[model samples]
Target: MPYIPLEDHLPGITGLLEYSKDTAAPIRELTQTLLRGPSTLTEGERELIATIVSHRNQCTFCVTAHTAAADILLGEEETSTKVKQDISTAPVSDKMKALLTIASLAQESGKSVTPESVQKAKDAGATDIEIHDTVLIAALFCLYNRYVDGLSTVTPTDPAFYKGLGERLKNNGYNRLPEGYEHLKK
Candidate 1:
């Protein structure tokens, strides 16, 4: 059960977003711009940043959703799983690993991100835009993780559900809710 009353069938952030379109509208746009919009980082890379931060925060809902999205974008879920398990040894490029390190520190505390982290990302071939976006994505997920977990939202236990959600998010993008989002509306 959610900390606040929400539609019984709607889970996680879906219900929370639907509960107030006023807030959801802007949040939706922000996500669309951050995760779906054009960027030097591939969609998979951006989603990976989000997934890492969510994992650091111990927010199961955000982690599950973003992990699926990252996997869908990357064409393989295992790679993302490996990165989450150990970014240093993951099959991703050195630049990605460097960016992930920055994301991890951002998840801990924005101030924890140091000049060295930025320089390491640059050394790994990450551009200024990539570094900036990685930090933003990491900080954004921290807010999202808190939003989902703080409300005690209902998290789906089934992997298939998250997989399906990943497809929906990838195909439809976050500019608007998925087809079934209407069910949560008053």
Candidate 2:
């Protein structure tokens, strides 16, 4: 059971959102803008940043959720699995590795992202906006990870469930709810 009683059958952050819609709206909006918004980084790349940070933070729900998102966006489950296994050696571009480094540091402490880290990202062709967004996504996930874990929310163990949600998220985009998710709202 959740640490706080939430509506029945909702999982992970969805449960918390159902418990509190006022808080959920802004979080959803921020996620929509950060992960779904247009940018030099592909939606997959941004979701990769979230996956990396969530994994580093040891937030299982966030990691699983974002990894599913990344998998759908990248159109290959292996790509995200490789990155999750080892970002430095993953098949992604050099720029992505450098950005993941910055995200890792942000997971530890924002102050750990030194000028050198910024320089490395720049060297790898990461623009100012890309760097800025990477840091934001990393930092935002720290908050999200803590929120989900802190609440002791339910996390489904079924892999197929996540894969299905991933496809739903990719098709619908974060601005609108997926077909069955209407029940999540107040």
Listed in order, each prediction's TM-score against the native is 0.94, 0.92
Candidate 2 per-residue C-alpha lDDT over 51-138 given as tens digits, one digit per residue, 9 for 90 to 100 = 9999998988889988998887888888788888898889999999999999999999989999999999999999999999999999
- State each model's CA lDDT, in order: 0.89, 0.86
Residue 99, candidate 1: alpha-carbon lDDT: 96
Q: State the lDDT at 14 in candidate 2.
A: 75
Candidate 1: stretches off by over 4 Å? 178-180, 183-186
The lDDT, on a scale of 0 to 1, for candidate 2 is 0.86
Error of 1 at 36 (Å): 0.9
For TM-score, the strongest prediction is: 1
* Highest lDDT against the true fold, candidate: 1
Measured on C-alpha atoms, candidate 1 has an lDDT of 0.89
